[model samples]
Target: MGVVSVKKSVVLLSLGHACVDVYQGAVAALVPFFIAERAYSHAAVAGVVLAASLLSSVAQPLFGAVTDRRALPWLLPVSTIVGGVGIALSGVSGSYAVTLAFVAVSGIGVAAYHPESARVARIASRGSHTAMSWFSLGGNVGFALAPLLVTAVVATGGLRFTPLLVLPALAGSVLCLPVLRGLAASAANGSVAAQAKRPDDRGSFVKLSIAVVGRSITFVGLSTFIAVYAQERVGGGVLAGTIALFTLYVGGAVGTILGGRLANRWDRVTVVRYAYLVAVVAVAGVVFVPGPAFYLFVAATSAGLYVPFSLQVTLGQDYLPSRVGTASGITLGLTITIGGLASPLIGGLADATSLRVALAPLIAMPVLSWLMFRTLPEPAVMGADGSDGRQPAPDVGHRGAVAVGVDAPGQVGDGDARQRS
Candidate 1:
């Protein structure tokens, strides 16, 4: 494939990624509407969020494991449609049980879409951190847009108009066609080579996963309640909440791009560790700061948490070269969604006490993340051809040695290499 074609494929994949994640963001965006329309308690609405994540979390790793053994590009479009359909139907019925079920169905679609999409994105990106960041930025944009989209559609027409929410999914599914065709053409031409097998670094990946879980809990916790919390802090009603949520998510777009640039200069582990340190301070500010200043802190927290977002996905893949699918699934899917598991607990606490108090505990999550990252070693960088590449000089303050590189077993020319310093 030519450079133009590769860039086009990556762009389309990123758009498709945006479409699918709209539903993921929409789930949170819909929380306020659910409360207003149904008079559901904090815990009750949190259960709805739980439904969206519970099934997805369990199914993501399974899907990744399956894709590890077989490439399922078709899942991209199919899952996109399924995810949209579930969310589209979620608010149509008033039955709480039915809503939960539909949301769970959406979760399944989301779970199915991520592992394969990550694989495709990695291939299309050719192992460039900037390219992968753009792919991740698409999802962040989707998340940022969800509030505005949901508020526009459902706020004016109420939850019954949720069918309109399916538009992005349909659009996303169509977007997948050209990219899939391009991939097929590349495969037919044998431009895609088989990956050389390498050993998996299970220990580093475990530590990385734990750090991701911490970040996840912090991010998901904030995303779930930041809107409502904003209202409590500022008094602009729904508009205040929407703006806050947007600020939080939009900051992530900035962070993803910034992370890519930073990774090009420093090893990913160092970048991630420092980002978490920033997060620890930023999260505290978000919790205690008053008035519109709260928005600034929210943005800081989002940016700090997200600066390592794409880097972590690539790091997980590098740490487990032999299980890219599983790594992608865990980094991009399982561990990320696992944060949702805490939503109910947060909601229950909010119900028993207050949103502020419930969220206060989140301040420590990034601290734990920083601690985990402190112990992680940077994996060996791979070349564009899937061979071990020259190691860059160690970054200042980096403690762990860069591990020796190995050619992992997989399709070669998939762009699994880090940028050369």
Candidate 2:
């Protein structure tokens, strides 16, 4: 009534952007730009980015599992420190080998993020489903905003200013120190408490996992390589083509907000399933569309398909009540890594045939994603809290551990159980 009570939502969004800034600018979007600026081959760019995705994705699940048992409040600041350093160094890298190393180290920082951030949202919010929708929207926004930031700097300051570009990230990192300290202190004092225990959904999880992995081949293919695609295949200036990638981001931004709204009002699965149908059309259209007219439809594909990302993350968070950290990490990390891995193969196909010819697999991904999601039970039918169509929260009283705040694992140290183990 007095002031809008969206503190939790704000915090979630900020964290999302923090995660986004760490990767999109320095890793994903940077790959091709670096190739052009540094004069490297397309395959080499794919390989370096592959290193990034693999490390980040693999690390997320492992770290998420760790956070489940122990809360470490300092991870936020520490991760920012590592991420900032890696990014700053990357901007200055003179050789492809060194750049690859920089991206790999930066990947570690990004890898540390999802598990803790997702877990925090679950443990902190009363409505994890709705919260995750907004939570994921934050990340979506950040990804959308990255190119603008890159364009602004490169436009005004030129590529030389890139190395010093770590300043903003460093500032963001330093600013989080107080926030992380408070989280740690609260966890240490036992001020935060565990969420209600929930049943795990083995079968639904498997199905969703397959769906996301399938979808990722398309999502990553588009996200990672779209800018380059425009330059080479779309018959536009590099700057124009670069801006074209922003169309996808524009679509994605809308999709994130729209996806959240859909999750709040309807079935998350319905929204996600529909996104695939749009993606299939978009991928095909993008491949065949000629000249400037093609950009408009590509933008449509981006908007229609990207909106469901939040839905996917929310579903995963809801499904794994006891393991939000691990689930978030895997959902994001593994799925996108699949795309990252497959992109090189796509690039090779383009090398042999053509860029348009290599992208055929992208159309298939959504179909597979949709089919896999359909087999799982509807979230509402299974008493899902807007998660994977899985079991509901277990009785809270039965669990032995008591977690506090968002950092139930080590990001925030949980208090020692008052009762004996």
Instruction: Give the per-residue lDDT of model 1 (tens digit) for 22-80.
Output: 99999889999999999988998889989998989889888877666566779999999
Q: List lDDT for all candidates, in order.
A: 0.81, 0.61
lDDT of 2 at 355: 70
Give lDDT tens digits, candidate 2, residues 1-421.
0111235434643564445454554455665567667765667777776777777767878887676666543565566566656765766657777777877777787677666655544433433345555666556655666666666655465556566556555655555454444444545564433333457676787788888888777877777667777876566666765677667766776777677677666677877888778877878888777678668867877766666675666566556545655666778676567677777887677677877787767888878888987776654322323343322231121133434334342332333211000
TM per prediction: 0.92, 0.84
Candidate with top TM-score is 1
The TM-score between candidate 1 and the true structure equals 0.92
